[model samples]
Target: MTQPQGALLVGSIAFDDAERTMRTAATELGGLLRRIPDGEVGPRFHWIMFQPDVLGQAEGIERVGEERIPLRMLDARPLRVADGVDPREIRFPELGYARAARESYALFRRLREEGVIAPGMRFQVSLPTPLAVVGAFFPPEQRAAIEPAYREAMSREVEEILAAVPHEDLAVQWDLAVEFQIIEELPGGVAAWWDGAWAGVVERAAWGVDLVPHDVEVGLHLCYGDVAEKHFVEPRDAGNLVRFANAIADAARRVPAWVHLPVPIERDDDAFFSPLADLRLPEETELYLGLVHREDGAEGAQRRIAAAQRVVPRFGVATECGIGRAPAGTTEGILRTHAEVAAPW
Candidate 1:
């Protein structure tokens, strides 16, 4: 079960909530995670995990800040569930959430200092993207203003996280579910907004990147909704590829970091990657392809791995999205299957 050289696998524990509790994440995917590479024993691996202490609840508008703080004093607005306010805007006390991030950073620092990771391991820390914060509250029309707000907030968050982790040992991944926020909107508005926001993030990162120590890994995990209902976030249509391509290309060119993406889940469209491969990205930027489907069985997984090998050689293996919604046992099978399929390649 030891990982072979250049063995590609999914990143670490993905949780269902923003708080990123480890036990919660472990319970959600531990069985399978424990089984992979003979229960976490194998291969030069890539892991994705959340810093729990840094998180607030995804519930009521104000999930940020210390749990001890009263919501009313913290800018948290009260509303009836039926009142129709968007769920994310309920802000918690800014100071509390900010402190929480600091405390969480300590925990991550401690774990690293204690050598929680094995030798030769590279890990990626994931946080909610700036767009995620704003989109969670605003409607399509209001989303335009979120970019500026998120940029300032996110830039600070990124800077703090980079300071906390060892620059050389780990990588950072900004989870961008918000980029797909306007999937249901007219393509023109959605595309324009995302393009602008993507640019803003890159600009913010210019300073944020320097905060990380030299040689620290930085990446962007771009996926549409991983939830069961929302399925694919962007249009899978022929014309839709152009916009997506632009977004990916722009992010790559601007950020110059690894870009991990989910495979197109709705159809068997290998061609969807045609635009991606052609993107003007650095040769050093790695592409982690989500080759194994959460719902795929042994046969389906084999097909997926084989198909992907045809396009990219240095590609890594991962799930289409986090397995938070799936039963832990099912997710375990996926991890194991990914190892099996990639063993020969």
Candidate 2:
């Protein structure tokens, strides 16, 4: 059976012990990762949600849930704005990528020297799009106002990571789940974050990528939102992902190292992948289809890979989103499926 040439991890592997996490991934999937994440070991359960709540201060911000709830909220009060908050001062809290990446990179170095990790792999740092954070918690009217400050803060985190990690050994991925809302027109519920067409979205999207230096690899993880392990809206096809990725490629000053698009588990048909034939990415920019699912493992990945090959002659493999929120004890099987379905790098 044919398989992709390489593989990619879209950040957040599932493990509580940081050292154990690095060792496991480096041992099992070293050949697949061009970069490695810290297993998101701490409080990043939903990836980027918890980090931003502490970035900029909102005077009236209050949590709606008392203890625990599936959906957390900031009590969307209409006519309310984050006006008192200085967006310029927004900074992601303690688990910032700079410190986190450094720690993971040190462990990765040790593992590589011990011959557990593949040589020359960089540390992969994943970040949420500013709009993803703004749209999720901020009021609609304030999202635009709040985005600039938050975007800059994210850049600061990236700058710190670059400063701490070697450029030759670093790769950055922008977690772009919310951008799909604009592409899908936010069918089930109107999202407060996006109000512009594809062009404006592209312009904003370019801002995120441009922050990374040319030498460091930059990639975009285009997603349909993974909340409680379900999409905000399952894609009917890959059309919107293709459209959005092309727009970003044209708009950004530099080409991305790769572009990753999700494949809903049920979408192993030609229709779901045919839009990839229209993808106009630069040759150096790799395409990674998120086709590996924990549910059916290698067999499911193979079916999706077969369908994708008809349109995309070359590509890599990943899950629809990070496996951080996946069921416990399923991580190794999912990791193995990626390696099993794709040719090792």
Candidate 3:
């Protein structure tokens, strides 16, 4: 297996300006990263929460909100299920991901020519899994019926991306916070709307791998839900992440090009990474451990690196989750921390 020598960005950079984000990432850490995101900017952080709006606009869905709870917890109904909505006949009124990615890649290409971004770095687009949308917006009973339509709509977004962007210069990542919610089944935590089974979640994610063309770089960001910049369930250890990642890798026909896992801020200890010893990834897959934290900086990253080395010989570094929702003014320091702990590619 090829060992990673640098850091990876888990998308959603804080920079609201797409062009500026690309410039900074390329000039500062281009060598360290093979992929760069469009920086889930402006409305994206909260856009997924408003997916009910999109579903409501669709022909066969109804958006109904809970009167008692906060406005974010929407309960979308599949009118088509009651009205015989064929999954193939269903189509979303809008596909946001494709539109955003196309806009960003234009900036990335311009930067590459301007000598800011290096040649051949793929544009990374992180997408919430269709299951995540189904789980977050619809009520438990409606999820099973709603998922097929949502998945088909999500597939259309991917299709549009592939048509617009070059396969060689594109990377698609399935952001997977909701899967962890299912895996852990936390008390009072967000519950999975599907048949709450570990294997089912893994299978769905692997099927997502199949959604992307094999030639396009495919990756998975295994995460605990990162709402308000905090994990829904802080991982007690890497065991669940290890188990889930291996399942996706095993089930995926086209092995993932990379898989990222989180590490708790305080877990710079052997016990946290011991499960990594059982991790079975394909030789070409890169493993990125999210161990770098702003609080500990370089010294803390070194501690996590040391602990991780005891179980797995080598891996790359990243922050535990996207830095966009983090406190303002901390993004640059966090980016620099990755540089401090690991060398550039």
Residues 11-39, candidate 3, lDDT per residue (tens digit)? 88888788878887877787898899877
Q: Compare the candidates by lDDT and give the number of the best one.
A: 3
Q: lDDT per model, in order? A: 0.45, 0.78, 0.81
**All candidates' TM-scores?**
0.61, 0.89, 0.91
lDDT of 3 at 316: 93
Off by over 4 Å in 1: 1-116, 139-147, 183-214, 229-257, 343-345
Q: How many residue pairs clash in each candidate?
A: 14, 0, 0
TM-score of 3: 0.91
Model 2 earns a TM-score of 0.89
* Residue 148 shift from truth in candidate 2, angstroms: 1.4
* True-structure RMSD, every candidate: 8.8, 3.2, 3.3
Where is the poorest 10-residue window by lDDT in model 1?
A: 37-46
lDDT of 2 by residue, 169-195 (tens): 888899887777776777654354544
- The candidate 3 region of ten consecutive residues with least summed lDDT is 73-82
